[model samples]
Target chain A: MAPTLGKRKRITRDELEQPSRPPSPSSASSESESDSEDVQDIFRRAFEAKFKPLEVDSKKPRVEEVNLELEDQEEEDSDWSGITSDEEEQVQVVEYSHLRHTGDRASKAEQRAFMSSKPPTLSGSTLFKTRPSTKAPADENDLTEASHLKNDVALQRLLRDSHLLSSTSTSGTSTPTLSAVGSQRHKSTDLHLLSLGAKSSIHAQKNMPMSHRIGISAKAKEREERRRAEAKENGVILEKERRAKKFTKERERGVGGPGVGKFRGGTLSLSKKDVRDITSSGGGRGGKGKGKRGRR
Target chain B: MTDETTQTLLKFTGHRHLPSRLLLSTLTGRPIRISQIRPNNVSRQGLQPHEVSFIRLLDSITNGSKIEFGMSGSTLVYRPGLITGSAEGLGASGGVLRHELGRGCEGRGVSWWIIPLCILSSFSKGHMNVIFHGEGCVTGAHPVSGDLSVDSVRTAILPLYKQFGIERDIELRVLKRSCAPSGGKSAGGEVQIVFNHQVRLPKTLHLLNPGRVKRIRGVAYAIGVGGSNNARSIESARGVLNKFVPDTYIFSDVSGAPFIQTPNDKNNPSGKKKGAVGFGLSLVAESSTGCLYSADVASPPEGGTTPEDVGRQCAYQLLEVIQQGGCVSRSAAETVFCLMAMGSEDVGRIAMGRDVIASENTIQLGRDLREFGGAGWGFRDKGEGSEEVVVSVVGRGVGNVGRKAV
Candidate 1:
């Protein structure tokens, strides 16, 4: 599908005002000269179909784009129901022309059916009543992406809270705080907060491509920083730790100042002269030469 | 967790080898009852501090476990529970949320504790990242707390695990090394481990011949002592092992000791802070056919087991392990034997040379494996003397269903 920036279907003022008017399957299939105004009507309807979702809502300020998109679709389907045969063909031709660029028209239909069949609720519902194919995280990620579009104020606050919580947990033990959050999350059935290992099916994410649905590697850029930060965590078993900033420092910290043990185990007090004696005389660590083979 | 009513209790006489019994019981999901736990002795009848510590450790990683005592701490009852996946699942949401191992304080007998735990890892669902806190980890061979260190586990038992099919992403890392008898100094030398688990059973450990020893590597550790002490021990060990293996190198490490304040200087036993100092050494021998045999020796509490003696003893112990003619070492033989017999239904073999018979502990372990099902299995000495004896078995294919599908 073309990106949202390219190829928008413009709406005439008529469809914008009368979006609820239903289309007929049996529109007048008569001679064209008498019904010239109908050609203009078709363009108005086509324009409304193309760009109505992108229009700003002057009405209720808080309705989510997802719902607006769903509401727009419901209106279009209702309009199509009343259109006559030849007019229906014209209206559908326009719909198909616009939809072919935006992939998966069937998903749009499915979503319309979903929104209509089940009433959207303000509060989260259990998994049993959720749309047959859409798993919970998909909905969450969709909301997250929508908010991500332009400095999602809500998402930023949530991210800040999550960031603080993660930093505190990593710095030390914050079991009580985590338990409290867990309790709060339990009270509200936020799917991400719950440790439910439900196997995700495809329908819930049909709107998203496989890449966006997985949300794994595409997030690698953000994940790289996390990996670096986490490399400081307990420890990773590596054959050779690259001299990255993470591995340069010591892991097992020392006792407080002048406390008990030395900084790292202990050190040999070898005078400069004694050091020369060991190294210059060909003795010390990582010995290179062959051992003096005693005549057996 | 399992139902108590479904259990047919396996009974034992005393507290001897209780860890093995408890591990086997946990693995098999069987309830156990031991009536005469030193019932004859009466005074020292109840479980020791370490044994009780082991039980607490087991409880930490499991769900719905129950334990009861009867007959004045002599008779005991324990019902097995499910192996809860990870104590801290994913640690947090995203930073490093691969899998959870678990967190527990392995008080004593950790050497024995790790064997059963690693065996469990083989049958678990995902990767496990376990962290152990508290003391008694870095010490030498103690009767209560077993000696095997993280270093020993990495060099010795891990190879055997590889032979058994868990070949990737296995680690035994010592984040902090501590000696035994840490008297409230700090978190007694922390260690973290990451173990990978798969669905399939472990493959056979068919190390038929170890060939001849080619090279030797060792570590000489001196806590709160000068590096000279470590160097002294390394030089001494070389004197003995050099005759057989020319490529012998012992790296010397000198770590500062934890300070212990006593009523007077005389009462201080370890001499770590009060000046006597601590020293120990471990050696590993590599043969031509890529088999490893290892041994370790440590200083005693009385400031005995001098550096020279430590190096010499460690080297000699390695010699003993190599002379046994099998690919496995004496210290690790018991662990290797148990994994082979307990793994899925497949024939596993280990070459045992007459230079050393299986230790009494290994023999007891063989008997214990039999009790937990693994039928038609025993220690078979195939050779009288010269060639290595091969002990083979077909396991019961006992896979742990405790780990759920993640």
Candidate 2:
């Protein structure tokens, strides 16, 4: 026991001097290494002053001390062994992901309701839950819900385009395309656009030549007039003759144009009608001016 | 109108519970004469600044109210008028009555005036939209005066109006935040109350269920301090409250101190100074049946307490309030009881905890209600070995004579 005690004392003395002896040799061997170490020491001290004292200094020294202790133990006690390289290589992973459930905190809607200037209502706790729940469990319920939604959409579309179907049926085509293919599809789309507050039908020819459009409108009027005449001769009560809607054309002007006149190739041109319209005051106007105003 | 003048004045003494007495007087349409208010205190006698500010507010909101004070300011005779809330040409501009508290009113919180005004707004003839701003408007909790923060008043007390059917278009907006100032200082906070719902009579409430606490919500605020203070308080509060209730969430609010315009002096004519700076915690526990319990704590004006202290104190206070086990907490009991007493001519039963019922303020409110010709309250045990009691109050048939014709 006395020899063991002496050996332990000697070993601790050696350990105390061991760190000092190694650093002195390294500093003597390389000046730049010593200088860099001094710089690192300064930074560590400054960091410690601002925030927390660092444990890196103590940890590195303790690791080396532990290695020395293990070496001493290996020489003294042959049966005991320290941690092996395999143990050091193995890593353990700890996870706390499951601890954070979504329900632990207030939802965004709840926050808005409570933090608002208005007094929180009694239903604030269950207000978010009262929203329309689209989530349904069970495969059977899912299938039925899907089919119901599909059928509802189909019925809505059919009801919207049912007038088109009726018009086709009157033309002796009993099978009015419920599938909405070809011409029927265009008619259905036109009806949908009208119901959504579209200004014109989808079949209306845009960017047509002036002569073609005029001829088409004239033919349509001639046909209507012929049918009206036939109905009158037969003494059958016919509907009133529908009139075509007139579109007013306002000429687009350049930003640098004269305010009340047309600009073409750096020239301001004002028609006599335009001048007369500008000069006319409230209800004091002649027949020609009035007719022109009414047309506008 | 002539009969109102001929009615005898209800006589009362002392300045204790003066605000509630004034509220009852306004509500009941009875004149009151209070004498011997702090006559013993020679240096500081008569009404305090906050109390005077409250009286001024009541005077502004009411129409035809006649007020007279004695030479020493110890005696006051008040003839309350109809509650014409924020009417034009009555100290209100642009439909908002702006009541300004002076520098002397730094001790008490702004909620001290707001809570009572809310009760008056319910029975007002017009929509009540008042903006309270001034040097002494402390939106945070008062450590010395025992007044709640404005957050608790909004989240806890104002929610009770729904039970009485006076819940429409009501809002309490905290425009500026300030904590209680130190001695002789000011807190330039701003708060607004918009109570537009006016009814002939509030619905009779029968709330007997003190349900289990489903979740806890809170607001941690820091004014003129670091944002880290709010985080600190929130962490500490959650530390204590999380063990009991798993669904606790505390929101953080940080704002700079409000600047108050001071009188011109020789050195700096454009006098401007920052108001009080502090942090506070306000916790509100909501139950399954819509019952609310609240607790408030703010750092002392002298500034020794930490944010952790305020948070822990608030958390413990909330736990104690919940442990009392009632439909309404102590801070909100006065509003709940007064509104119940002024409700429709029907019996409204509420379950209150034992300690809340036995509080001094509750007892004083009961006596004051009786003095104003309101009915007395009847108490009964809730169940066998339970700490709760069911209080039945019969409301006066005469509710809001201003609104009676409508």
Please, what is the TM-score per model?
Answer: 0.51, 0.65
Off by over 4 Å in 2: A1-110, A123-296
Model 2 B-chain TM: 0.98
Q: lDDT tens string, model 1, A174-287?
A: 643532265444332343433255454322444757777568544865576567667768475434434437565434544553322234456435456554545554544344
Which structure among the candidates has the greatest DockQ? 2
> How many clashing pairs per prediction, in order?
24, 0
Q: For model 2, what is the error of residue B173's alpha carbon versus the real structure, in angstroms, after optimal superposition?
A: 1.5
Residue-level lDDT tens digits of model 2 in B155-248: 9999999988888899999999999999766899999999999888888989888889988889999999999999889888888888788888
TM-score of chain B of each: 0.83, 0.98
lDDT leader: 2
Instruction: Mark the regions of model 1 whose C-alpha exceeds 4 Å error after superposition.
Output: A1-296, B1-4, B40-43, B89-109, B139-146, B182-187, B259-277, B354-357, B378-387, B403-406
How would you encode candidate 1's per-residue C-alpha lDDT over B1-406 as one tens digit per residue?
A: 2346567788887887787788777766777887777776755667755566667656655566678888577777888776653445323132122221112232352455566666666665455556654433443333224466455565566666666666676666555444444333321444556675544556666777777787666566676767887877877788788767666766655667644334345756654442224677767677766677878776664564567887788788888777777767767776677667666677877677654444776667768777777665545666655566677777667665654343
Query: What DockQ number belongs to candidate 1?
Result: 0.00
Error of 2 at A233 (Å): 32
